[model samples]
Target: MPVTDITTDAENLTMTLVADVAAPVDRLWRAFTQPAQLERFWGPPGWPATFTRFDFTPGGRAQYAMSSPQGEKSRGTWEFIAIDEGRSFEVLDAFADENGEPMEQFPAMRMLFSFETTENGSRLTNVTYFTSAEGLEQVIAMGAIEGSRLAMGQLDAVVQDLRAYAQGQGTRVELLDDTHVRITRFIDGPRELVWRAHHETELLKKWMLGPDGWTMTVAEPATDVGGTFRYAWEQEGAPETAFGFEGELLQLDAPRREVTTERMSGVEGPGTVNDLQLYEEDGATLLTLLIEYPDKETRDTVLATGMADGMEDSYARLEAEVLSK
Candidate 1:
């Protein structure tokens, strides 16, 4: 999984996404080409996609439907223009009817997908071009940016599972105690990369926030004993709801371990001391997070906030944007 970037350009009538997935180029290419895997993560979180037709050669076509929980379905098609196996492809994209025909009422566009190998994994650069600025605005106004983010977020889990199977181990998370939780994961990088991501403001902003619609408005990191840092965020449309976490560095052992006491604002709770341990494991980094709450009740309360899923998403994004970099 990489940091999924979704942005639109009004002047150029283009939408682009640049992601770094911590998987081999061949694996990602296969996932895109194979109908079965493609359907698993082709749509946003709540919608599951089904491909009725898939042709993988140049000048081929793909037709699929994304069905929502309410039983409503959205159909789409891709008319492949050119293809270079395991490298890149270009296609014409348009809304389609359930019967495999274009929906003339909807807009159509062109998309180009390219893959480049990185030091640790692969990078995908996807650019969608619209025929006119009005067409671009039509899709964007219809929630294209949000939908693209949700769809790409789904890709993180799929690629991570594939990598875990090949690694001989999977990520483990546990409730170690009534007032503590533990998370251990095999990060596909050296310990230094993971450590830098945790300690640097620039790297933290890349993937630290749990999901889309939130931006890191403030980031100040000082990884020294007794030093303090402030990290804050604001929702896309809710400035009044902006919140953050401020903490003091209690212990600092570069690339290995860190200890801190943090107070989270914008949410209810007292300060908690956290300890993180990182080490090399089978050519990868194994990160262990020990969370300590002020009381058992607070720990239970925090757990009920769906923090586990948020943390999982963060770690996956860390791989996509930070570790692979």
Candidate 2:
């Protein structure tokens, strides 16, 4: 289960799980709808299981007995409410006592599983709907959160294995058009040090700019409104290393916050509009850089070149250098 979107409202708890399996939707559906396939990865890992019965159809029931590591046995049941071949299925689940009776008057949960096909593979989503707040609370008290997470982890493993078996290949990273990347570092230094490392030329040279072999030519700062600055970098044994911007200091509110826009150019780009913002938090500073390109193609191209990773590494180095001082 991918567990993509999870939310809780004033009255109900909803969770959506997504998975991209190697096999088609029909195969994936069978694996979920068949009792034998589900028992393989249904329970928490390392727990002794005794699945008393399983009937996969509308109005059917599934009963399972599981024993913890400490030898405590627990039982549960799912009443199948609806079924859709190769598309979706819904069930109402609850805990059962020793006599196979529901102990608590909890709400009936409806879990719907849907499958869709993509060029790369299949997309499977599991949407779970809780009836009421009290029903959601009752499951939480029974440690449902952790249990559900463990179940999803198991499901992911199963999907990975099935995909590998079906495709006769290993897992591959699929990059989508709309992928967002952000990095954050916690620096144990004065907020001023971190702030200056980005804004001041002298301080930037100490950390932001690379070592001596790397020549940082420009050191211009416009501290007021409409002020412009640019810095050029060149490495000794490498091609002319250059990435700078010609932009205005839209706002400079001191050590607390600052915002700037720059039109960057060089090896990485012909030109890109960049916006940077800084915020102070708990004696530390949080810096955010937002790059806006002319189009999605440009953004995807930049991302493919690992620019985000490079930026993250540079910021990590800056954090270490600032704290060392």
**Number of the top TM-score candidate:** 1
Question: How many residue pairs clash in each candidate at the backbone level?
Answer: 2, 1
TM-score of each model, in listed order: 0.52, 0.45
lDDT of 2 by residue, 1-325 (tens): 4444444454447755566655566666766777655654466542324567778789988888765422466877888888887787788877788865565865567888788887766776777788776776666678666565555544543444432322222112222224322223444455677777777887665555544455556767677877787766667666556656566676554664444555664444344444343434345444534444556777678778865545554565676666575
lDDT, residue 196, candidate 2: 75
Model 1 stretches with alpha carbons more than 4 Å out: 161-325
Candidate 2 global Cα RMSD: 18.0
Candidate 1 per-residue lDDT over residues 1-325, each given as its tens digit: 3656778898998999888888888877877778877775688643557798899778789999886433467999999999998899998899998687878987678999998888878888899999888898899888887777767755655555534533434446566457666666667888888888987889989987876677788889866788998899888889987888998887665876677778885556578877776656446776767677778888888778877677767778888888776
lDDT of 1: 0.77
Q: lDDT of model 2 at residue 72?
A: 60
Q: Clashing residue pairs, candidate 2?
A: 3-17
Error of 1 at 80 (Å): 0.8
How far residue 179's Cα lies from its native spot in candidate 1, in Å, is 26
